[model samples]
Target: MADTQFSLVPKVINGGIAGIVGVTCVFPIDLVKTRLQNQQPGPNGQLMYKNFRDCLVQTFKKEKFFGMYRGSGVNLLLITPEKAIKLVGNDFFRYHLKQEGKKLSLTREMIAGSSAGACQIIVTTPMELLKIQLQDAGRTATVEGSKAAAVKPPKISATSIAMQLIKEKGITGIYKGCAATALRDITFSAIYFPLFAHLNSLGKRKEGSHEAVFYVSFISGLAAGCVASFSVNPLDVVKTRLQTLTKGSSDKTYTSWMHCFRSTLKHEGVLAFFKGAGCRIMVIAPLFGIAQTVYYVGIAEYILGIKK
Candidate 1:
């Protein structure tokens, strides 16, 4: 029989490990997605990247291999807790939301997932703000350098960014795109968790066991991630633009998410909202594939002599 008891410590540890592994493997792709989403048309309607391929090629040519990971330090550090809250928080809610001896209703499952998404934004907002800054800093520097003399911009780090935001705008300064983040994450999780659980349930299970096979979980996570990532790409774009502090003089400032949405729709059109969608799928698929597999595999359980 499966272990019905919830063990907080093991779940937290497993979530942290899953997060670290997933972020490390996919951070480069995520950086590309951020850069793509942040790219706005120039005064003459010229864009920095024609497409994802162009963006990847340009980044490789200009920034090299290491540059692909520009903002990864902060992402890796904070993603641990952000993902921990998201994954384990979902499980925690699902465990409680279900009535004893009854399957959880799909609505309750969505609520549980949404609650997890809400819980994670406390860390996600600041983490994303700093990450977008660092990831897009190179693009900003590159554009400026091309127009001006070929001088490299001074290096900036996550610690410095946090300190400056704290000093200049207080602690709340770091939560620049919180509303957008919440919309994207909550929607994504609501869709993703239910879909992943459903798909995983349909897959092959271990002999005489309730759990799906590891590969099944991975595939379920990947499929769910791709669908959810694509579905929320518009919100992701808005969030990226809102959080970006290194806007050119021509860039428009928005008062809120609605303002940003309307302005972007008016200026850039609907297709603009899908910026970096492909890259986001690329990043998220492997991320949650690896993350869910590791999480379900119960590494902590093995270590601590707990069975699930």
Candidate 2:
């Protein structure tokens, strides 16, 4: 009887729930992305963000707890659309691929994830720029020993920052880092969804068991967390630079995506690509994964009556 009633609509609902929960829960990592991307290396020639502890402490002392969550509003705006694209797109790709008899392997999942990621980039880029500028207010450039200790940044609020951006650059200015932003959404989705599906498959249990589904979700969440970070780290750095650069730019410096990438790489060392990876793993990935897993499993059971 249950087999007769199973359908794709409930699967989509569960997927949407998972996407929303994942993005919302891991939002702190989004802030972390802003901080890492916007980081200007200290005078000591060392990397700015050593990890989560350093970034967190610095943000509290310099920017404040509220400061860390700079573009939270923008995030809320991006989540629904991004999540929809990520979940629905991935599943759609999976369905088509299966029709072609593609093996449900990690590689196949990555391809589906990559496609979904690319799709979400269009929806997510502008909001991502808003997030970046909000978080970059009075961001410190030097964190070397005494200099790091002595620096007290200018006071600013999200509203003030928004106004400041408008006055300085205009609507386009607020979205200055859009290309990079697109890159982030696309890259993460590409890595996250596929890895998640793979892990869930790994953790599959006997039919009609809530405990089994929960465990599968948990493992899948962990894999998605780790894989998403790797695929999207470089794009994240570029996104941060594009959005966060204010005083440093000439008229044309922030003009295009190519310009942003080349300039950031030229000025900051190659190592800049990996600025906040550890913190992201600790904060963003795990939180997002857990949220995603719960949403996926919970939504399905809710709609389908525990798959009895």
Off by over 4 Å in 1: 1-3, 147-153
**Candidate 2: tens digits of C-alpha lDDT, residues 124-184:** 6666655665555545433322434635445554567667778998866566666666677
Model 1 Cα lDDT, one tens digit per residue, 1-308: 32578789989989999999999999888888988888777788867778888778777766788888888889889988998999999999998888877888999999999999999999999999998888888677766666434334459988998899899999989988899999999999999999999999999999888999999999999999999999999999999999998876556788899999999999989998998999999999999999999999999989999767
RMSD of each: 1.6, 4.9
Residue 289 lDDT in model 2?
A: 63
Backbone clashes for every candidate come to 0, 3
Task: Name the weakest run of 10 consecutive residues (lDDT summed) in model 2.
Answer: 244-253
TM-score per prediction, in order, is 0.96, 0.74
Q: lDDT of candidate 2 vs native? A: 0.63
lDDT for predicted candidate 1 compared with the true structure: 0.88
